[model samples]
Structure formats: C-alpha cells, structure tokens
Target chain A: MDRSVLSIIKCFGTELYNALKDAQDDISEIRIRKEKSVVVYKQNIPYAVTKQGLTALELDNAKNEYITVSEALIKDAFAQLCSYSVYRFQNDINNGFITVNGGHRIGICGTYVGENGIMRSVRDITSLNIRIAREYKGCSRKLADIAGCEGGILICGVPSTGKTTMLRDISRLFSTEKMLKVSVVDERGELSAYSHTSNGFDLGLCDIYCGYPKQKAVICAVRTMSPDFIVCDELTGEDIESVCFTVNYGVKMIASVHCDSLENGLKNVSLFRLLKTGAFNKVVFLNRSIIGKIDAVYNIGDIQKLYE
Target chain B: MNNMKIIGAVLIILTSWLTGIMLSKRLSQREELLIELKQLLSEIKRRITYEMPTMCDLISNCGTQYLKPFTDNMYNSLSGGYTINESVISAVADTPLLCVLQDCEKQLITDVLSSLGAADSTSVREITDSAIIQLDHYIGLAQENRQKNSKVYFVTSLYIGFAAVILMI
Candidate 1:
C-alpha cells in the first residue's frame, strides 16, 4: 500500500478500513461527516462502500448501503492526523488542514475556537476530507519548457487541480536532473510531503523549511540554503511579499495559486502586483479534469497587460 | 554429616545476601527513574524551545528502559487516533517500570505526561519547565532516600532472612 493510503487505513476503524483496503486502487478520498454515511471519493466522484466490500454509486443509495461514520471514529482519525497531540497541530488545525506523511492533505471541519479574531484550535470536529496526494513525474516538464525553463513559474488551479502534485514533481525534477539547489518552503508540509514521523515525498537535493510561513521561509531559504530556485505551494496572504523579496535577491521560484482562468489569475490584485514586480515569469494554469494538462500559459507580457 | 550442615549454613547465608541485593534494587530503581524523568523533561524543554519536534521523535529518541514501554504504547496508540493523554495514561499504567514506583511518583509522572503533547506551545513549555523543576526535588528526595533506604533494605533483608534461618535452627 502507498504510505498515504496506509495512514488513512490506520485512522479508519477496522470494518471501514478493511472495506477500503479491498479496493484501495479505486480510492482517492475518504470523507467522513459526523453521523452521516462515509463517502469515499473515487474516480472524481463520491461512492459509499458497504460492509460486504460492495461499492455503491452514491452515498444516498440506501441507509444500510454506506458505512456509518461514528463520532469516535472521526475524533480518533483527527487525533491520529494530529499525531495524538492537538498542541502540535494547533496552528494547522486553525488553518483547517493537516498535511500527513506522504503529502496527503486532510481538510478539517470543526467548531472554530479562538481568541479575538484568531483561530486557536478546532473543537467538536464534524467532518474530515482526506485528500490523497499523487505524484506524476515529468508531468510539468512540458509546461516548464513552455513557460521558460530558467526563471519563475507559477501553477494555478482550483483545489484538487494537481497544483501541489505538480510542484512536488517539478522540485524533484530540477533538483535531481538539472542539479539545481532547490529549497521548498513547505509551510503545510504538502510540497515536500514531509510527515513528522516519516518523509512523504522525496524531493532529491532540496532543502525544505517545513512549518515556516511563506514570508519567513522565502527569506530563510534564500539566505541560509542558498538555493538556485525555491518551490512552494499556494500563494496566500503575505506570500507575494515573500516572493518579491526572493526576486530582489536574484533567486528563482516555482509556486502555485488557487485559480482556474488566465484572466482571473492575473487580475488577482496581489498576484497582479507580484507579476508587475517581476516575481514570476509565467503562470501555468491546469485543468483538474486533465491532471497536468496546461489549459493556458500566461507570460509576463500577458500578465503585465492585465494591469494595462 | 558435618559437611551437610556446613553446606546448609552456606546456602542460608547466600540466600540472605541474594535477598539483600533484591531488596536494595527497588530503592536504586526508584532513584534512577526520578533521574531519568528529570532528564527526559529537560530534553523535552530543550526541543520545544529550539525546534518543534513531533512527540514520536521526542519519545523515540529519548525513550529508554522502563520508559520504552510508555513510548512504544504511546507511539502505537497515537497512530490509532487515540488522544495523547489517553495513550500516555494507558502507557504509564501498563509499563512495568512504573509499577514499581510509589503512588505519589506515579501521579507526578501522570500529571507531567498529561500535558506533554496535547497542549499549546506556551502551555507545553510551561508544563515541561515546571516538571523539570518539580522533578529536581523528586530526584533529590529519591537520591537521598536511595542512599538511606537502599542500605536499610539490604541490611534489613539480610538480617531478616538470616534470622529466620537462625530461629529455625
């Protein structure tokens, strides 16, 4: 079994785990909503696996057909993801996701507990979406070549659109084949797939700064690791500033953002500012239906024109 | 007939000495456990202050002897989605090393572990730091007790065993 799948199985209660293990190849996500049917995401669709190892087309097929996710099971699975210590994962839980070993991302949903506009912890968790991470080696090779092989590249896609997977492979490629020193700012441990207990993805020759936010990681990676390129996943708050800081120091970067269209991507105020600052050379957009297929590639010229 | 009596007398003496050794071993173990716990808490404090290491990393790297069972139990149970406190409580309860400890010592260890992995960073730091300080007193008491009690146990065991033999004779 893949290490990611193994983690899921270990978190799953015995009966559900056995059923999923019987048909592991067809599985992608294991979604558990409190007191609701356990819906396993497979083939880009959700299916309910029965106790007899039979798969139903939909969760609403029949009450007895789907696995019933228990509150205890959800709590147990959440604890496992946190490594049995919520204190360790408090920040990540506040952010509503925990990256497990092998780069799998567990999207958490729970009662937000915090103090004065800050998310301190997640309590009374109601649902968990375990998203399995897949690596497609050489998937971004053509896109990288098209987007200009030497400078900055940003992969843009919606959730589950292979943004992180592409970054992981690209980091692996550049660091291994080209012999470039790549630093991965794995704020969420997604890109490097670094689990606390075991390493998830192997980004050969890349120095990863796990758990550090983008703003700090970019500066630290450039100053300490002296990488030729820094790869990261997701451009969120304060990320543009970090990327700009790296650009000023003459270090290249490969990162991703959440968006689908070329226009919307560049038109994003922060991203537009980042493009204008010459932080990224190209924005490579991906279609979730086609995995790594580059639906559009917008160069600096195209991106700059958006501001015009 | 003389040789049999001589052999019996030697056997009784040997048994008394063995009993003394066994009696003293518990006192020494209690002392050692306190020292080890102090060290473990210090290590945890250092790790948290400098780096955010996983509980598994902390336990696996530092876990030794009697603490090994606790770490092992916790490591296995954590993967099963059990809470840190619940797993650790079970681990401590199940560990043979802890079974030899006094009730107060066991309670101290439990309180220390309860807050170890499942709290906020600030709280974890505070707990570990306080544990290190409190464990120093425990270590000192255990050391002093070991010094006084080990000899006491050994002498008492030796005399008791030998006196029984003498009384029988």
Candidate 2:
C-alpha cells in the first residue's frame, strides 16, 4: 500500500473516531478493501464507509428509521481523510454544519437548536454528504461577456440550480480572460474551490480572502486588495445593505443566490431590497432542465415588466 | 644605614607597587564587563524588536491568510448567504489593525528583554517582574480593544435592525 494513501486512511479513521465517539462506543474494526476504500463497521453492522468502498445500502429491520449511510458523515470522514484540510464546525450549531478547507462541502442535517429565532446548532445529525467541488476550465464561456461588462450581475436560481457553478465560471472569466483584478469573497469556499492555501480551481490572476465572513471579506477586498471586481457565492443576510453602501468604491460585484423563477428572483424580498439599492444592474436567472441542460437566462427587469 | 630604616623603606615600596597593580586590574576588568554588557544588550534588543516582529508578522500573515478562507466559509454557512458585503468590509476593517498590533507586541517584548539583559542578577529579577507587568498591560489593552470592537458590532447591528428585516424578507 502506498504510504500516502495509508496515511490518508489513518487520518480519516481518526476524524471518524472523534465525530462518532460520542455516539458509538468503539470503532471495532476498520477494513480497507482494494487499497482504495475503507469500511468502518461497529459489531459488523456497517455503520459508515468511504465512497470508494460504498455499495448498496443495507436495511436494518430492527432500526425503525432507514439505515442508509448519510452524506454529512461521509463528508466529515473525507475531510479527515485529507491531510492538508482543516475542518471547522460553525459555532452556529442550529443550521451549521462543517466546512472543510474552502472546497469540499458536507451539509449538516438534524434537529434545529434555535434560540430566540436564531439557529444555534444542529442536534441529532444523522448524516452528512461530502461533495468535492472542482473548477472546470472554460465553464464560463457563455457567460463571459455578460459578466465582464462594466456593471454587476446577479445570478438567480432555485436550490441546487447550479447558481454557484455559474458564479464560479464568471469569476474565472473576469480574473483569467478579462485580466481584471478580481477578489473572491468565498464565504463557503464553494465559488473558488480554494483548498490547502492553493486554489482547487484556477481563479486566473485573482486574490481570494478566504474564511472571513463574506461581508467582511468583500469590504476588505475592496479596500486593500484593490480589486476591480468582487465575486461571491450565496448572497444573503443584512450584509447586502453594506454592499450597496460600498458600491461607491468603484469595485463591481458578481454574486449568486437561490430563487425559483425570474419573477421569483426579482420578487424575493432580499433580492428586491438589494435591487432597490441600485447595487446591481443585471439579474440573470439560470434554469436547469430534467436532463441536466442549462436552459435559459432571463432578465429580472423583464420579469418585473411582465408582472406589472 | 640602620636595619630598621632599611626594612621600613622596602615595605613602603612594596605596598605602593601592590596598590598600583590592583587598581589597574580593577579598571581593565570593569571596562571589559561594560563592553560585553553593551554588546549583549544591543544584540538582545535587536532580536527582540526587529527579528521578533518580523517573525510575528510572517506568522500573523500566514495564519490570517490561511485561515481567512476557512473562516469565511464558516461565516457564509452561518449567515445563510447574506454575508457577502459584510465579509469584505470586516476583512478590510480587521486585518491591518491586527498586523499592526502584532508588530507592537513583538516590539514590546523585545524592549523588556533588552532591559533585562543589562541588569545584574538582582536587577534581572526586578526587570523580569517589570516585563511581566508590561506584558499584562498590553494584553489588557488588546482585550479592551477587542471588547470595544465587539460592542461596536453589537450596536451597529441594533441600528441596522430595519435592514436586517429587509434582508430576511
């Protein structure tokens, strides 16, 4: 077995042990099959396994709930598997999960722990999925011109609507092709695929302030990095107002958000609020078909016109 | 010449020679000790002030730069995507100041260490005590600044309650 691969497995095992220790008494046996995968079973029930070794989920009739392995747990395991990665569980336990590096994502699912209308932590989390995000070259070819234009563009789509993908591609275009000084406030590391102090995706000649709060990172980028354009993923929260206020700095913004339709995108209270501030000039809606095709782009103003 | 007179003359000459040699040795030793002390004190001061700060700057930059993306990701997850503007603004607001403070702390430590070096054993103990006092002062200042900043954020959020409502809507 390669030393590096073994080391990775060992790390994974340690992370799994830590995460599950509170729940499980002991990780009885860990078996690595074909030098590519590891399966961890407690008393031979197969509680969790790596993706490389994942097969069909076996049902345990005794357990009332479905016994399938969870994505969140797997993601946490994978993060531990990688040597250079850092894993942080956001203190906001209610809706928070774990963030690995700036690339891989593992969303948490469980009971919400709320405090006075704010989510504090997630309890009884059953599973987690680890998605490895990659940046493909030329992904932004279609959107380059629109993104590179002088004004800012807002990308709108529903949940799992590839909004982040489009934003990533646009950032690449602005940084690499247009030769613009781009600063990516990658709050989730989703947009830039930044991992291990090196970017998993080619952001061209861009500066990324990773791991800071998105609002702070964007402000910092504008003031210090001297970026001509700022790109960020998943714009939400009271910070949008600050973005509006800071537009006089002359740095343009490109960001993504979740909404179902063009009208929905514009009518979204947060989106509408941001729009009213005149912070963005263009809004593009992304539609993905059932067969996984990027269907169309709609202007927010046009949608509003139709609504009127 | 009488025996007693001769003996007295010899004693006087011997006493004078002994006294002169002793004085010369004492003065030379004192000069050497001063030179050694000065050289050590300067070297210590430079290490504390210049080299220490440089090392700290490197560490802070490396740590902040390394941690920034990770922390940003956490912030994003917590804020539920509404954190973009705040992300940039906070980064701008906090990092340079942190770098400056780190430099200041390094210089402070160096100053204390340099002072301690020139001190004798007893004085060294006294200097060490003084250095600890100085460190406590700076640490307190840092904590106070942090508290003040935290308060500012709290107040700002309170004032921006309307904006927050708009965002949630």
Q: Whose DockQ is greatest here?
A: 1
TM-score of every candidate = 0.83, 0.48
Calculate DockQ per candidate and list them: 0.49, 0.02
Q: Is the docking of candidate 2 incorrect, acceptable, medium or high quality?
A: incorrect
DockQ of 2: 0.02
- lDDT of model 2, residue A63: 29
Q: lDDT per model, in order?
A: 0.77, 0.51
Candidate achieving the largest lDDT? 1
Error of 2 at B27 (Å): 43
Tens digits of per-residue lDDT, candidate 2, B42-125, equal 443334343322221222333343334423433443234222233323443344422333555445434543333222233444
